[model samples]
Target: MSRRPFLTLPNSHFFLASRAAAVVTTLAAALVAVSVSAPALAQNTPASSAAAVTGGAATYDTAGASAVQPDDTNNFDARQKDLDRRSTDNNYRYAVAEHDCYSKFFVNHCLDSARNEMREKRAVIRKEQLALDDEQRAARAQKRDEQAALQRAQDAADAPQRAANDARNAQAYQDKQRQHALDQAQRTAEAPQRAANEQAYQQKQRQHALDQAQQGIGASQAAANQKAYDQKQANFQQQLDAARQQGAQKAQQRVENQQHFEQKQATAAQHKADVEARQKQAAEKAREKQQQQLQEQQQQQQQIEQQKQQGK
Candidate 1:
């Protein structure tokens, strides 16, 4: 009888075969799982957010073309906040999906799908964010334009007043220029008087020097000059005192006249008011008496009609 030889493979080869079978099984499972869940994950905020991104595309450009209306501004913050939350949530879900892919056989495809979904959500959020920003900017610009228009209208309305003020200022400036011209002419006219005064001052100084030289000639002449100077000073002081007294008297007289005028005005106004009050009272009494008499006449006529009807 012939003995049959049993052919055996190496342990490593069997191990490799088993590992490859397990890898194939895992790959199929991962593909099925990803196929089922990729849509769900992509659709996390997809339906409504996608609609918003599409609809708001028009609004984003509308602000540049026409103007943003009040309706477009409604729920702006709420919509933006929703987008922001979705963006954050989308990134977190991608992280989770990517982490799950590491344990699976095909990590690259899983990561690629997660990244694509995250980008799609980000694009949606970016579009909505851009739309909100455009809307806010348009509203601010419109308000600024309206305010500027109102300011221009106000300036237009005040144009006449401003022109009148400018004209008055010009007249005042002309008056000031005329006054300055007059002052200059007066200064020119005073030049000769100033020269004469300077000449007189020079003559007085020469006379004073001559007097001093004469005083040096005799002590008696010096004493006479001193007496004359004392007399002049006394006379000047008396004149100044008298002038001050006169000024005080004039000021007191003016004050008395003003007080007297005020009293007279007050008295006259009070008398006029009293006369008016009396006239008003008399007129009011006469009107009341006339009204009472008219009412009594009407009542008597009504009674007479009643009596006639009773007789009939």
Candidate 2:
């Protein structure tokens, strides 16, 4: 087929070519108008960019060539700022075009054309936004993966030391537990002997008190005997307290076990609370009894005071 020149074309072909040329010229003018008007929109850009942490910038498709060029990979922040500025300008321009459309004779058609151009530009911006989002997500995911790998390597390097520490702790815990158990068993086995000794000592003290009374001991001698009895009781209490100190160490040895138990005891928190409630009630009753005893003593003291006043 021989290609005909523009001027040598048939009349109908010429008209068609002229119409096509007019359409091309119109689109070119529209593009130029958009470019020029977009920048004329009012805006204020900040001094610093927020998206600089982005590792790589994603460039937009060729259809969005009119858009501001993307910054280098490390300067995604500026690219983002540029995109935002353009989007704002696009909206501003669209609003102005829409206002102008309302004054045209073909108002609906003008509005439609304006809307279509705005949407086209918006689509380009949206595509770039999607690309930028994807790149940001990828960068974040890569950093996360790198951190995870580093943590795993560090954990592996420390594994032997951790294992050795655990082994020594286990050995120490076992020794303490064994000693604690032995101490408890010894205390339990000696309990009967201790009680017997205490009872015999108390009986001897009582017999000595009875003997003093039979000998018609004066009030001063009785007071001395009472003081000696009180001293013995205190010494006995001190010995019991010494034994309790050993029990306290055993209790401490059981502390780790108690902690392990406590982890499981989360399930029994309600039961523990109920027990605490019952203990609180019991303590309240005990305090009430003590208060009653104190009141009784006060009443007795008042009666004695009244008797003395009467004697006076």
Q: Which one is best on lDDT?
A: 2
lDDT, candidates in the order shown = 0.59, 0.63
TM-score of each: 0.38, 0.40
lDDT of 2 by residue, 1-312 (tens): 132232332447676567556655655676576566554332222111213212343344333444444355445676566676667666656766766654445656666777877876765565456455445545665776688579668868987986786677667767877987897799899999988998998899889889999999999989988998899889989988997897687687589676775564554566657866885796687568657645654664465457558646
Stretch of 10 with least lDDT, candidate 2: 41-50
Task: State, as a TM-score between 0 and 1, how close model 2 is to the true structure.
Answer: 0.40
Model 1, range 217-251, lDDT digits (tens) per residue?
Answer: 57777667767766866886698699769868865
Model 1 lDDT at residue 45 = 30
Give residue 183's lDDT in candidate 2 (0 to 100).
72
Candidate 1: lDDT of 196? Answer: 100
